[model samples]
Target: MIRTGTEYRDSIRDGREVYVNGEKVRDVATHPMFKPLVDIRARIHDMAHDPATRDVMTVTQNGQTNAIGNALPYTQADWWAKRRATDTVLDAVGGIVTRVGDETVGEMWSLLDGAEALAAIDPQFAPNIKAHIAKVLQADPFHVSANTDPKGDRSKAPQDQDPDMLLHVVKETDAGIIVRGAKYETAAAYANQAFTKPTIANWGDAALSDYAVGFICDLGAPGLKFICRTGFATRAQAEDYPLSNRFDEVDTLVIFDNVLIPWENVLFYRHTQAAMHIRATLHRYSAFAFVQRSLKLADMLIGAALFNVRQTGLDKLQPVQEKLAQLAVWRESLNAHLTAAIVLGERSPAGLMMPNQSLLYAGRVLACGQLHEMMHIARDLCGGQISLTPDAASFRHPDTAPWLEKYYTINDEWGAEDRRKLLAFARDLLNSDYAGHRLSFQMFAQSPPFAHLSAVYRNFDWDGPLSLVKDAAGLSDRVLGAKTLTPGDSSLSKWFATETPKGKAAK
Candidate 1:
């Protein structure tokens, strides 16, 4: 069901403990720091009911309307619809804001796709996943993910160090299990729930352990505290830091002090195999949305840089054009990867469509690993003026206004105010603290760079290359006997053989 903005805002006003900048937030929907994003999220909910955007933001299912983002993607069309819905939201907000439900809801879908693994552990777990997926569609609550725990002392196990270092079960009661630990989650303060699970770590060879647990955490539950990092919106004027003021998604360190997860909310518990399975395929469906953010970010980089160069008539220069082309290459490279991954989508173990893992992960590596360099290039193209520009207040000040206008005005086409606005925008997009945080988010939000490489390694068709080399080197079958290079060995390798294009040019 689709909820209005007011309903969405009211839902999170559950008197949950939330703090920012060392001060307790009385109302997250009214707080100066969180209100902007909360309003945006509420607007996203209202979009499903508004006459203008209702069509794009929602879908008809069982003769009832539901948020498109919550719908499970069963066909390629569903994925395309989800992608378009996300882009529409970004366009409406005029900037990128991750962790706003659509990006995180797919985490549950990944769990849904792992029903068999969950079933192997406990029969109840698979049904719980299906119920949660349906709950998301029916209730349309704001959802987020919880993966990275504040793991202390990596060298030592949880038993050696503080047992609470990693989120583990302290005790199991008749109602549910009480877990103690902390998780670094984005939007946890305002979000309704989080799909809490294990991070990227060694679970060890164990059949059952308290540390290996997964559940749906209600953010408003008792014994939970949201200690968020200071927001960028309240740090400066909106005119100076446009992206930060409106698009900053404040992350939080959610402290779970013996929080209880009712039995129904527990997706999997006391099952190391389930935890390992979840860690392995956690981002199968979610990475598509995560990488899509980078695509929009790439466009923002190109847009800000191109407009700056063009405003100064520098676009005509061959060198400037070369730099512009480089930005386009990065943008389109991301575009190609996303597009091709969808076109070559694969069916999940549970019969759900998943973006091609090899292309999606390789694209993630390219988009994230090279983002800082791209930002640097954009900053260079914008010139030193971005850093030297004065704030909006200085432009409007009575005494300094005239001198600022005289210097900032480039030509009749580019007036002082326009130039100032553009410079401020470029500054925030490329040089501000928010810009750096965004770059880091892209690098490590999903996982680290090394993890991205690992996903690519696990999914990529190594045997195809191996078989080609062995055949070219005239190796005997005995030498190549121990490997699986056949087409039907795996679903992805099968797609690599049939769906993916061939020939040297294809490479």
Candidate 2:
């Protein structure tokens, strides 16, 4: 059955151990920093129950239609459907919320079904992992995949630094293995049912052997501690801060202290290559999906930017129009790349049809570079007004209202109070700390920009374009060197007009 927002909230009421700023949070659902985010998440869940969005947001399984939450396609057609569904979902929620939250983590768990299928290749671990996945599916459980280990020194390998810095198998027994170390920057682990695959592959040879371990453990499992980080959303109040209210689902560093992983829950162990393969494949698919999300976000930002310009009466200025046009170009370019990726989707060896990796990677790289420029344009166009806008309370104050109304109102058509509210909404878009966090998240979500660009340059089929150029230049064997090549071999050059040669007749 599709769960309502309230039902989702009630389900998580059980106290989970969440530590923030050296203090433990008794209830995340009630925490000011977490509540607005949770409320927004609940709204997403509710969308699945709404008649309009129910079909797009949910799928039938085990004789019931469960909220799709974040589960996407395993085939090319499925990928297209998933992208369409994702657009619907993001549009419904307003793009203020990033796709990397509880719902996203849960959807990642569903993708683990594919991982378990691969693990099944090893007869020993296959059945157990499959069973583990079955259990999770049956319960409609939430999971956060923790792969980023704490690299104490960026240059040092996991084994070179402290083995404990990376989550590794501390002991093995017939029942299972015990793991220790920390997983850094995991999103919403406190609210998840389990943390899957801590410490990504490539920790070290010794580190890799122990670190290749993968498993699912309860969030409240013994010795597990969630060390929360303060985000922009966490430090603000919802009534006064709408942006944080909708987007502030805090991410945390998860510390594992000798956490036990049952043998049945292990998908990979001591197989670093296999582990890396699993991770690489997952990144390929997941990153592709995230590009779709970034495109949707760009669309939202474009609309908001245009609205801001219109509100400020700069819509007709050629320079402002040029800025908006640039933003539109970035938005369209991203969408075009994403669309191409979807159209060229292919089937993975695992039978999952993922988007075209090259195009998707290009979309991601473009998103990183373009978003920064877009934000800069947004800030520049909005001017000092974004930062200096008076608080909502000031307009209501008897003493401040007169002066604020006289000077702050833009045009005669809009009142001082109305203008202030509009500015507040614009400030919500431009000046909020949530916007900064979102920018950083988008920047690092796929991979570093240079690495992404290298992947795109290496993977795209440049040979196709080069062949066209070769044919145009009469370099093809079909041309047979019948004529000497000139700088204007195909098209006429203004400086080198084709005149009848002294000895040869013009064709």
Candidate 3:
């Protein structure tokens, strides 16, 4: 079932502890710093009920209506529908938002894929995951992800340093497990829940440990505290920093001070093998939504840069055309990977449709690894005026209005006020404080660059290339003993072997 925007706003008014900029937020929905994202999230909820977009945003299955984002993907069409729903949300919000429910909800699906392995350790884990997945559809809560603990003193173990440095089960009560520590989570100040899990680390050879725990954290739980980073929305005037004022998704360090995670919420506990499984495949499905953000970001970069150059008549230059082509190449590369992944979607052990791992991970590497460079190219195309432009107030001031107008106006087609607005937009999109922060956010949003490469290594078809080289070298049959090597069977063949519904591209 879908909720109205008002219901979502009221849900976060649970009086949970939330602080930012040395001030405690009395109401996240009304706070200036948090209101921007809260409002966008609310609008997203409303979008599902709007007649214009309701069809794209909701799906009916088994005679029950649910948010498309919460529906489990089973067919190739299901993935396409998911992609379309996310696009509809982004289009309505007018910017990229990475941590909304659609992206983080998939983490549970990944765990669903590993249910058998997790159930081996604890019989209750599998059913718990399925139940929570159902709850996501039924309750329509705003979900987020929680990883990346404070993890102080890497050189020392949790026992050697502060035990609370990494989130661990402090004790187990009859009702639930009490956990203490903190996690760096984006949008936790207002989001409903988070899939709290272990970060990627060296989990030494141990049968069981308190640190290897994963659960669904209710953000409004009694002992929870949200210590948030300063949001950009209130940092400056909205007129000059449009993107920052509207699209800044405030991040927070959520302190779990003996917070209670109910037993039913526990996805895995005291199982290092399950923790390892989670780390290995955490982004298996979620990365589709994450990388989709970069594609929109690419469009933003291209649109901002193209508009700037076209205004100044630089679009006529061949050099300018080459730079624009470079941006398009990056944009299309992401599109290709996302499209190919759906066309060759594979069926998971849980019977859900998964994007082709090799293509999806490879696309993630391209989208994240080269984001800053693309931003830089866009910044270069916007030219130095983006940095030197005066504040919007100067153009409106009576003392300087005439002077600014005379110099800023290029022709009748490009008026002074229009020029001022474009430069201000370019500044925020490329040179502002928010731009820098978002660049860093994109780079490590999923994990690190090294981890991206590791995923590609694990998923890429090495055997195809290996067999090609061995055959070219005239290797004997005994060399590959007992293993049949198809010399040039493409990776697509293996992915298509899975019994998933054929995507339109495949048919």
TM per candidate: 0.95, 0.82, 0.97
Question: Clashing residue pairs, candidate 1?
Answer: none
By lDDT, who's the top model here? 3
Clashes of 2: 2
* Poorest 10 consecutive residues by lDDT, candidate 1: 498-507
> Candidate 1, residues 1-507: lDDT per residue as tens digits?
678889989999999999999999999999989999999999999889888988899988788789999888777778889889999999998999888998888888888888876887799767788888888889999999998988898987667788888999999899999999999999999999999998876666768888888999989899999999999997999998888999899999999999999999999988888888888788888889988989999999999999899987899999999998998999999999888787778778888888889999899999998899899999999999999998999999999999999999989899999998989999999999999898888888998888889999988867766776667787766776766354244445565566644331122
After superposition, which runs of candidate 1 have C-alpha atoms over 4 Å from their true positions? 482-507
**lDDT digits (tens) for residues 1-507 of candidate 2:** 445677767766666667886677887777766776677667767777778877776777557665454444554444555666677866766654553342244334333545655554455766664465455444544445565776677577666777887788889988788888987544453354554564444455552477676676667666777788875664654444566666665777888888877786776777676565555444556665566677766665666667667776889999998988888888898888877665555455445455666777778888887787888887777677768877777777999888888887767777776666555655666667777777887776554566667667766665445445666876864443443333334211311364433311111
Better of 2 and 3 by lDDT: 3
Q: How displaced is residue 487 in candidate 1, in Å?
A: 9.3
Clash tally, candidates in order: 0, 2, 0
Q: How close is candidate 2 to the true structure, as a TM-score?
A: 0.82
Worst 10 residues of 2 by lDDT: 498-507
Whole-model lDDT, model 2: 0.64
